[model samples]
Target: MIDALVNGLVILMDPFRMLMLFAGVAIGITVGILPGLGGLMGMALVLPFLFGMDSYAGIAMLIGIAAAVPSADTFPSVLMGIPGSSGSQATIMDGYPLARKGQAARALSASFMASLIGGLIGAVALTALIPFARPLVLAFGSPELFMLTILGLSMVGVLSGSRPILGIIGAVAGLTLGMVGGAPVAPEYRFVFGELYLYDGFSLVILALGLFAIPEIIDLMAKGGSIAQRGPGLGGGWMEGVRDTLRNKWLVVRHSLFGVIIGAIPGMGSSIIDWLNYGYVVQTSKDRSQFGKGDIRGVIAPEAANNSREGGVLMPTLLFGVPGSSAMALFLGALLIFGIQPGPALLRDDLDLVFVIIWSLAIANVMGTVICLALSRPIARLTFVPFYFIAPVVLCIVILGAFQETRHWGDLVALLGFGLVGWLMKRIEMPRPPLLIGFILSGLAERYLWMSYNLYDWDWVYRPLVITIGALCIGLVIGGIWLKRRSAGSAATASDNDGQERLADNRAGEEAQKGAQS
Candidate 1:
């Protein structure tokens, strides 16, 4: 095993292979900066060029693209309030707010640092777990997966902020939207309204861009200012961001591990890992006031998880030939093109290749982070550009992103519709994150529920993992409510103390006046 690891590293060190890896990282960064174009698109673009390339170099290039994207996508999410891809939607929660406060450099740097550390952690996990992960992967059956989806849904309460009812409404609305496509277990569709586009339901790109980006753009255009209200100077510089990540070191580790676990699950995609991490951090923190604002921790949590999941995603893809995501599916296809089958046989016969992948992922992450840090100052300056100057470009990019989802006119229609809905929700002070979370998880929940029911009837609920995860769901909800009440009670007590102090001061003044008159 040690020999294979060293050999893999040596192979990736060859000049041409290294150059291909660098090229992949550059392409990945470009794609990630454009809204909605993620690793999948980056991989697809490079696939044709790999036809007759050296197998090792080709694999290095693909791995580099995969590792770089989650890190690079942070650019749009932080600076413009746009989700560069589905994986980055959660970063907009606090990252864009930070940008508005002239902390774009801080946010961007922290995100890149967290991405670097998380990517390394994920690589370490992949290396350590590859030999022992088979049974762990098999442990999660349909019942367990359904419970996990429920666990994800339970986060809606925490994400809804001070308005639990509104949160519930938003989640339900999202579920309704997600259910519009073909039924998971049946042939019937719910809300197509006779349009063939509706038969496939809304694309995540359209939904995310409409909900987050369009509203911000509309408001910015109306408000007539740059994204950063404070102007060109970055209030918190790059070093501050690096400090913030280091300050929250344990947070980076926990969320990175969470990302890995979630990524390893076959059907769970990158869509919900960041949300889960965000919700967990909010739930566990004693001070929840800073979230959804410009809290650096918010930036850290999602960025860490977003990058780490790539390593976790490779687990099932390499071990069982089960692609965990669309990008992984592309990866599996590329493997087949190289005449390299993935599974137990590949593991036994080509362990060196597996290590090569690990090396590429780790190296790509380092390269991507260094490049992002070098570019952070210039890119972060975009926050100071006037909204009017920036709006048209952003609008064009967003529309193009949405249009590419299916290349149908309905994409534009849905983008406009959801944009209106998002604007209204923003006006009404309703939380949008819960809605996105609900939309992303609804299909998984329904599919798994049906699978569990058909396979085990009602008894699936009795499975140990199912019961365990269900307990976690209940605990999270109850704990969130309890923490909220505790925080409120503390505030009320502080207010009462202030009132009593003022009353005593007034009494003292009255006595002093009476004595002087006498």
Candidate 2:
């Protein structure tokens, strides 16, 4: 393993791979700084370029882009309260609040540091797991995969905010939306309405844009204000944010690890990473009450998880030929075009390609951070842009991007349709992220559950790993319930106290009235 790593390191030392890595990171940061674009789009754009390139250089570009995306995406979330990608949406909940408090630089600093840590963790994991990667990949069968998706569902509780019921409803809605095409086991169509476009299933990109991007556009329009009035601070407050991350090192590590583990399983990606990390931070913090209220840790958790998941996701991709997320799957397809097969044999035959991936990721993270740091001021200035202009442009991007996935007019229709639904859901205080989460996991969970059942005839249910994972899922559900109850009790107690104070004031007023009458 050491020898292979050394050989891989030598391949990464070449100037061409390094340049591609730098370019990829730069492009990823640019994409991430945009309000609607994400690493997925960046990867898609670069996919064609990889068609006939050397395996190492091609993989370098993709790995670099993936590694840097989270670093840049956080800038918008922290500066303008807008998410550059769904992964950074979780950052907006806390990072933007901090920006409103004149701590945009600080928030960016924290976000960058956390992203760096996450990138390192993911890269190391990807590199180290290469030896036994094939077995680890194959060991995850239908039951384990289903359990993993269930774990992702645990994030719904966190997305629900103060309303768990609405969260659940949102989740169910997501599941229904996910089931728009054909059934997993059987070959029958369910909700196509006889449209040819629906036969291939609704595009994940289209749904993502509608569910995540549209809601932000509406909120930005409704608010009629930018996130902050001031431009980025030239002061060294960004360094203070870095200091804050160091202060909470353990939290960053935990969240990054959470992202890696969840991301290692195919079908669970950035959306789950953000919400899962958010939920974990809220549940375990010493001052749990401070979450969602401009807490730096809140920003750090999602930022770390969002970045780290990139690496964790690459594990299954390079090792097992199982793409961890949609972008990675695309990367794998690009590899196949180049006659490069992914898996254990690739490791032995083309260790150089493996090194290129690892080093490219490391180098990309550094380059992305530098680019973000340089552009922080200009990007932060967007907060002063008029809300009206920002609205139409963002809306157009959302619409166009959504339609790009399938090139069908119905997808455009669905985009507008889901936009309205998303807006109404927000009006009623629904947690939209969980609904998306539920939708993403629903297909995977249903498919795996049925496959496991048919294959094992219930014997798989008793497998120790499967049982343990199920128990953990049960515990997460119960834990969510317990937390909700506790929160309700606290709220009730606060209400009772306020009521008693009002009663006392009324009695005092009555006494004064009686004295005046006498």
- TM-score top scorer: 2
Q: Give the per-residue lDDT of model 2 (tens digit) for 76-173.
A: 67766667777876687678667767888888888888889888888888877776654564566677766666665654664465676787777788
lDDT, candidates in the order shown: 0.78, 0.72
**Clash count list over all predictions:** 0, 0
Q: Model 1 — TM-score against the truth?
A: 0.59
Off by over 4 Å in 2: 1-118, 125-137, 225-227, 236-361, 476-518
lDDT of 1 by residue, 353-444 (tens): 99999999999999999988887666545434566875797678778767776789998999899899988998999977667656756776
* Alpha-carbon runs more than 4 Å astray in model 1: 134-236, 378-518
Candidate 2 Cα deviation (angstroms), residue 55: 11
